[model samples]
Target: AITQAEISVQELATHSGQIEASNKALDDIAKQINMFALNATIEASRTGNNGQGFSVIANEISKMSRSSHEMLGKVTSSLFRVKEKIDATTAVFATSHAEASRGVELGSGLTDIFEDLLEKANAANDSLGSINESIQSQFSSLANIQNSSEELATVAEKNAASANMVASVTEETAAAVEYVTRSAMELTRISESLSQSIPTAKMFDEWQPDDSNEKASQ
Candidate 1:
């Protein structure tokens, strides 16, 4: 989605360039038309009686040229503002994409930690099982071994709880990333529609975990 938004921005920039060029051309044409109208009026005045109709035509042409010039000026101004806004929006999207990428990275790292924690928990549980067998075989050593087993079991239980917490957090982060993705997609769609409507006038034809982010966000 970020990539698509960037492409849309580039395309918008291209269209802006086209608009600027067209506006410049229109300004030049309007100037020439005004000059022609002025010359025609002067010549018509010199022609006396026969020049009355020519004078009217020259006046109308002058009025039309002025109107067109004003209209083109307004359009150019509007397009400039639009271009500025699109540039700002592109910057914002770029920042958001970066933040979202970082979030995915963090989420992935957290998932790795969870895996490691679970592995350690399983190892402690297995050692505790072995200690139980030892206690059964060596009654004289039961007191010492029992204390060690209790401590190991406690550590294993705490680790299991921690792992569960980490899993819950990972799930939440995944959902957040998914939400961001959907939002980005919606924004891209909006920009695309806006770009399409732009040429009509011319008629020319983020923020959050590594594992959750990497898997769910994409």
Candidate 2:
């Protein structure tokens, strides 16, 4: 018993839209959080010693936001990732009418490992979404990062700027940091690509917003 491929196509389109909307929402949340830092600065300046406690809290939050900004930065740096998946999914959808949709087959040994990934993706997504909501402070510092690309002459220029900051903080050259970032990006792409190719994941083959949906392997 089966239905039309058009229905599946429709569903895939809807899912893709949802994922894009969620990413945009997260970006906006980041912007709002970044704005909080400005208010925090003003408050600290006004309150003086009283604001010291607030400043300390704000500092901790700024650190967290820095981390969040880095994480989102890394993700944005790889936006082409989701786009590739979207393209692949679109190809699959096009062929869904031409060929039978095959669910990945699981067997003796690799089953346990496959199950673990599915569990992790689900648990991470569930917890991440909740924790993301609960944190009001972490996004404050990242507000300005939204348009960093717009202001930047190039990624290399951004890297040089980061390099200068790193040198000031830790004595690293801008060129060195750029090398590190480029290598890191390449390494991450390779690793992510490898993980995506897992036979279990290849089955049930849904384009997830994050690895959190590994449960779809079910």
Candidate 3:
């Protein structure tokens, strides 16, 4: 848009040049007309009273030329002002174009930076996803380990119970062996006392002094 405005301003400057040229041509024409009027007045004076009407016509022509010159001057001044404004407008457009171009370059740079940041963000998201998966896998493995540990604990508890049962049976067997040993000692003492008491019964013993006493002594 700025470029188009600059072009338009340049075209206006060209038109102003053309208008100034035309104004100069008009001024030249006015000068020629004024000179012709002066010459006509000189000829009218040379021709005396009969040239009075001709002299008045010459004066009117001169006055018209002067008016035309004054108008042309005003036009020239206006064209100068218009040219100055056009030049100023053209400068402003040129500056605006430069600024706009710079702004576009900055915008493009910002876009590239934003794209790079977006790519990095996506990569970060992918990395986080991978990390989350890894953590889940580790949790699964830990769960399996915990389950195995619980199974081992159960087996250990069963083995401990079986060991406690065996220890109780062994204690009962020891108690029974101690009772049998005591009974054997008491029986031996009773047999020795009977051997001594039987001698007091000599008469009966003699009557029965057969293999009984011999077997007992043997």
Candidate 4:
């Protein structure tokens, strides 16, 4: 648009000058023809035979100047049209430039919004990653607890068997103590005749007391 405006403005200025130059050329032609007319009049009076052709030539020059004037008028009218078109086009160019600038401003705003959204998206992604990591840690902890519980169950089974064995040993020890007590009671009943069970003191063969045994007895 700027280029168009520059071209149009240059064209209008250049064409206006052409109109002026055309008018100047026509005016100069008219002046030259007028001088020729005066010269022809004087020559016709002084040399009647030679002046007829000079008069005709002067008339042709006048006619050509009139034609030039008519052409100049046409050129001037066309220049006015060109100037009006250029002015209108220049206004259009100015309006278009304004609209384009507004578009640029809108584009800038959209770019800012896009940048903000990108940042928010990145933040959300980071938060999600943190949450995912926390979930993973919790899962691992639960797995460890499950493993410990399995070991505890195994230990409990072993402890139950040990408790059963200890109960059996306790019953056997109680029975042995009861047997020992019964034997002690039986021994108390037969203890007074216990020495007669030994036969070592009896004289199996017609035993007579020797003189030394009698003395000892005394």
Task: Give the number of the best model, judged by lDDT.
Answer: 1
Report the lDDT tens digits of candidate 3 across residue range 1-218: 32332444355445445545544654554454445445544544554564455445445544544553454355445445444544444454344345444443334543343344334323433433443343334234323323332332333233453334323322332342243233223322322222222112222212211233334545
Cα RMSD, model 3: 71.3
lDDT of 4 by residue, 142-194 (tens): 23323332332333233453333323332332342243233223322222122
| Cα lDDT for residue 65, candidate 4 | 36
Q: Candidate 1: lDDT of 132? A: 34
For model 3 the TM-score comes to 0.42
Compared with the true structure, what per-residue lDDT tens digits does model 2 show for residues 63-135? 5455765665544433334434444544544443233223333233234433444444334234333333323
Better of 2 and 4 by TM-score: 2
- The lDDT-based order of candidates, best leading, equals 1, 2, 3, 4
TM-scores for candidates 1 onward, in order = 0.44, 0.40, 0.42, 0.32
TM-score: the better of candidates 2 and 3: 3
Give the Å shift of residue 172 in candidate 4: 99
Runs off by more than 4 Å, candidate 4: 1-49, 103-218
Which residue pairs collide, candidate 2?
A: 33-139, 33-140, 34-140, 34-143, 104-203, 121-212
TM-score leader: 1
Worst 10 residues of 2 by lDDT: 165-174
Model 1 lDDT tens row, 58-136: 4554554455445445544544555555445444444444655655353464344334433432343343344233223
Deviation in Å, model 3, residue 139 alpha carbon: 99
